[model samples]
Target: MFELTKLVRPNILSLEPYRCARDDFKVGILLDANENTHGPALSELSETEKILELNRYPDPHQHELKQQIINFRNSKPNKYTETNLEIDNLCLGVGSDESIDMLLRCCCTPGKDKLLVCPPTYGMYGICATINDIEIVKVSLTIPNFQIDIDAILQKVTEDSNIKLLYLTSPGNPTGKLINVDSIVELLKQSYSKWNGLIVIDEAYIDFTAPNGSYSQSMSTLVNQYPNLVVLQTLSKSFGLAGIRLGITYSNKKLSKLLNSMKYPYNISSLTSNVALKATAKEGLAMMQNYVDKIVEQRSIVLKKILDLKYVGKNLGGEDANFILVEILDKNGNPSNEIASKLYNTLAVDNSVVVRFRGNELNCTGGLRISIGTEIENKEMLYKFEKVLNELNA
Candidate 1:
């Protein structure tokens, strides 16, 4: 029911993307972009450093890397379907941040069209909207459980035709909740049909949900079914390649093609693409899942112990991600933001431990978001965190 062409901005649809030098050919003398033919300037380079493609402009389209991404995403198990997501169905960026920025520009007209984001959710969605000069509409997540309020979202979109993008996260940031498949399907049918806007789902922490491999929770599998649905993911969390700065977009050919058109000429560098390729390889995926297993196991131990502590209040959100969002207690065993703030500061400054204090966010009152770390790291964090909380309580 969603019409792709009608939703995109007129300027973006008609704009001719920058033609890069490497688009046509990668070999030969290649003087098109006016590059130095002598190669990299580093005279004394290591064996690994010497082979790095420093002098040459990286592949603008990155055909091999796209294929690798397609293979990796398609591997995530889905009972419904896995459409043949070809090269055109993928777009790579500096990070998911770049994709968010470009999506706002390509779809919404600044100062006119708007986007909707659930609060106590990821901050980047709003930040990107602000940067693009696009207005943002918010509908807070249902409390006691950080799930989307489907009816409210549907009503909001039905009333506002100018809302061009609706951003949601699976295993949501701060909340750490995975949106159910049924909820996504309902919103896609009702909200999308009425407004015909882009629904961007960020699934950065999906790997932790599954035991070791073949995670079936990814919304990427539904991309082919719902043309308007675009899933953004990154190697930063699951693959442990935050340094490579690779973010991926999976959607229908129309939306994916538009992202490719609007992105910078060489948005992904050679080093980034090379490292991402290696990370998404079969062996790399197995290793990533192994680490996921460890993290999940440690999360169980930490959550159980933390909740038993008299100073800790109710466990706030879902356990689908690598972090925990729980409240800090006052003397009467009530959730207290003041205590949470003090606990957050003391752990970082005094104990040499760091955890995010998400007390200000809606429904996250008195909450401290603690990340699941290595066995040794978690042990130390637990010892230091409990010790600090006790001191603050006393």
Candidate 2:
């Protein structure tokens, strides 16, 4: 019942993809794709800048970059990472935003199809759906723990065959918690006759999780095994390479091929590919791990220190990601958006420290999503946050 060909848009399936010259050949005269053979137009350039070849078109397929990503992922000794995972299983995009948009366009036809999202998860899932003219179907994550409302999601999908994609974020954006794996597996089983579709798990914050110093929680391990699974990751978060704008998608080769076919011929730029290649290199991977370790340590310290304040209520999230979500308390000791918003503004404008006010999000009343910073940065935030909270409440 859950057929991929049935699931994808008919036009996307029938259409032919544009072929870039670099797709078949990368060397020689390269008199194709209309790329300027002359070196870059800049007069002054760094050694690395010249090597990047800004004058030419980048590899359309990004096979080498994809392979390097696999190498970085396989550094950890997992069965899937060790075997069966290859360049074919991965797809790279400008950012997860582009990947999200591409998936929306290729699978969910405008005005007819629906996309399911778990609330208090990533905002772009809904934003992209709206942009693509796809209906947004939201199912809120369970209260307090922030786990998926599995029974509700199952029923919704079963009743609605039009729902083509279900989006979930582990170590979510505002929620900062890991979704239950068992619950995910149960849905993927597709016991319901009416529905079973591609499940997109956004793991942008994955590298910062499992505070036990492991990335074992990543849903990527299940990608090769499940044809319906799509795991989205990025170098922007833990890798400190946000400027490079590389987002990764791990799925079965068939679906990967479909995505490749539908995407722009030259979606990944040479600048992004080269920088990402370096960031995912052996040395780069080690450096990223070191930074992740530091952030994890700092997250604990910041959470504990903030929780001590009378104006700060419970730490709502699972404490999994590089950030913490805590409720800003009112005079009566309940979550208060008014006070949180005031504090959020005060911190940004006056104190030179900024944290996201997620009070508008579901189940996140008075919530301030604070990213973990360095020792000095954290100290400044703690001091300024306490001052603002006390002033607002008074």
Candidate 3:
């Protein structure tokens, strides 16, 4: 057998993970973790709450949640078409965050193996890598467009650099721009030729994208074709179930098995599994789709207003998702963190509106990442932002 420590960092190999008090007691009143002191949301099977059974262990495999997700994707008209995927090919996690950690655990050897990320993106990927003691290699995406610099990524991969995971976000977070599908396909092909690395495509915002298309566009079909490809998604965003904390990963059987083997025995809680299953029900699926439809419609209106703003520079909308990232500038054409801070602090203080300040976060020094809110909320935000701009000028 190979020495696993040689591949990972010495600290991780020697490390002891955080041991919680709840970890020991198999069955007891779970008053420690701060669960909803009341109970889960009311539903049709309200009588079930009367029968409390906290003794039995949760399913180690979480079969019901996986099957429910599989069935919902098949039966519902979500972006992921039924015929293109199956139940055995998927694995469920506490959230895609867990999946990110699992992948690092399964693949990386702390100090020896490293991972890559395109930043001005998700913080979790890098954070997870660091916690696991995996070295981080940064590849910056092109500004304004937030497209992957394919060459820069390729340049970073060398014989000495044993890169294990490459994390990518389409219609990326903070910036909200989707890398073109062709570019993703090209990166995957190159990665395969260079090393046996995994390409993780985060599709958290996929459902909100334009109908029948994604930032990476029907790339799920590629799971069967590419051995190293993985897709991570969460139930939180579009499903209106952020509190539920469930994520799904789609990949080939080999990769799926590797991830499943490395994850915690009872990673998904029994209650969470139940909640996710109910949320994927026919009615729940329909409700999610309806919500997405409204968000998309509102996204367009917000995009137009941002474009019309004099201080905001060349802004683009919906190549796929609901969030819009616009480049903002001053009358002097300089990158203005002042404008972003002013909008965030002023609007939040004056109108109790919370908009994401992405300017310095992603090296996006002059822009704001606006999430698509309800129509009324969107109009109010636009008006507030306009007032801020006028005041700054005055």
Candidate 4:
């Protein structure tokens, strides 16, 4: 029998994680964890709230939420195959951040193993690597398209056998490019055969890409085909549940089991689970689709309008996600970080419309990441943006 205990680091094996007082004694004075003895700060409780068993710990496995997620994903038409996922194929985390950290902890030995990433992508992958004391190798996305540099990635992987995980963000953060399924397939094939490292595709913005009923664009449906591939989805974006802090990962049962084993027990609170259940219900899903439709419609209109402005240059990547990555141009028709910074600050500080300034990222100089907003809000944002640009040009 293979014992995972032998593979874990000496420090981690001996380390003790902090436990709450509830872990030991749930009754009596309950002074162990230093929680407030006076009860919650709320002066009143709703009828629904009064029914909650707050004194008891939440389910560590979160079986109810897991089944809901399975049903939701399986409800979509599987473009790759007719297969459906079981609860065993899914794992829940505090957020995608936790899943990222857990993967690093389980796969990468500190100071020895490395992870590969494409920059102008999500910042967390590298941040997590740094926090875990693991090495990060960068292979930047190709400019003009913001697609993965497949050959470059393969070269890096071949040279460094210690690379344990490769992070790829589809409909990439700040880039807004939806990496093609073919490119992902190629990378997965190469990584599995060459390095045997896990390929993690962060699909956080996937819901904004296609229409309500379509699963054609998501890579999650392909998880069964490739065991080495892991796809991450979150309720934060499309479901409008960011405050609930629920993120999900889909992969093979073996990997899912490993991740579950390494995670903290009772990671998901009962309240979060209850709300998430409602959100995944039939009515909630319909409502989410309606919201997605409106956002996508607004995004299209805003993209077209922004392109018409003289100071706005190329849309840096594919407009596949809820956000747009557009270049801020100078009067001479070239990228200008100075103009972008000024526009970002002016819109935020003066007009009270905030957008991200991403000029410092690789190949993203003079870029601003603008998330899709309500129709009226989008119009107002563009009005403020143009106003700021005019002032700068003046």
Best candidate according to lDDT: 1
CA lDDT scores, all candidates in order: 0.86, 0.85, 0.72, 0.82
Q: Candidate 3 on 1-394: residue-level lDDT in tens?
A: 1122343344444545444445566456767655564555555334544343323445567666777776655443323233445665688888889988988887787777888998878889888988999899888888657799988887787454578778998768876666777788788778676756778899888777665433225355467666667888899888977887889998877567556655666677767777777788778888988998999888888888778987887663234576787766776866688877787788888878888777777667766778888999898889988878667756
Candidate 2 lDDT over residue span 148-244, tens digit each: 8878987888888889999999988898898876777667766334475788899899888764334367767677777788999999989988888
Model 3 TM-score on a 0 to 1 scale: 0.82
Clashing pairs in 4: none
TM-score of candidate 2 against the unseen true structure:
0.96
Tens digits of per-residue lDDT for model 4 on 285-388? 99998998998888889999999998899898677788898989988888999999999998999899999999999998899999999988998998889888
Q: Which is the leading candidate under TM-score?
A: 1
Runs with alpha carbons beyond 4 Å of true place in candidate 4: 1-42, 212-214
Q: Is candidate 2 or candidate 3 better by TM-score?
A: 2
Q: After superposition, how far is residue 251 of candidate 2 from its true place, in Å?
A: 1.0
Cα deviation of 136 in candidate 1 (Å)? Answer: 1.3
Clashes of each: 0, 0, 9, 0
State residue 240's C-alpha deviation in candidate 4, in Å. Answer: 0.9
Query: Candidate 3: lDDT over CA atoms?
Result: 0.72
- Ranked by lDDT, the better of candidates 3 and 4 is 4
All candidates: CA RMSD (Å):
1.5, 1.8, 6.1, 3.9
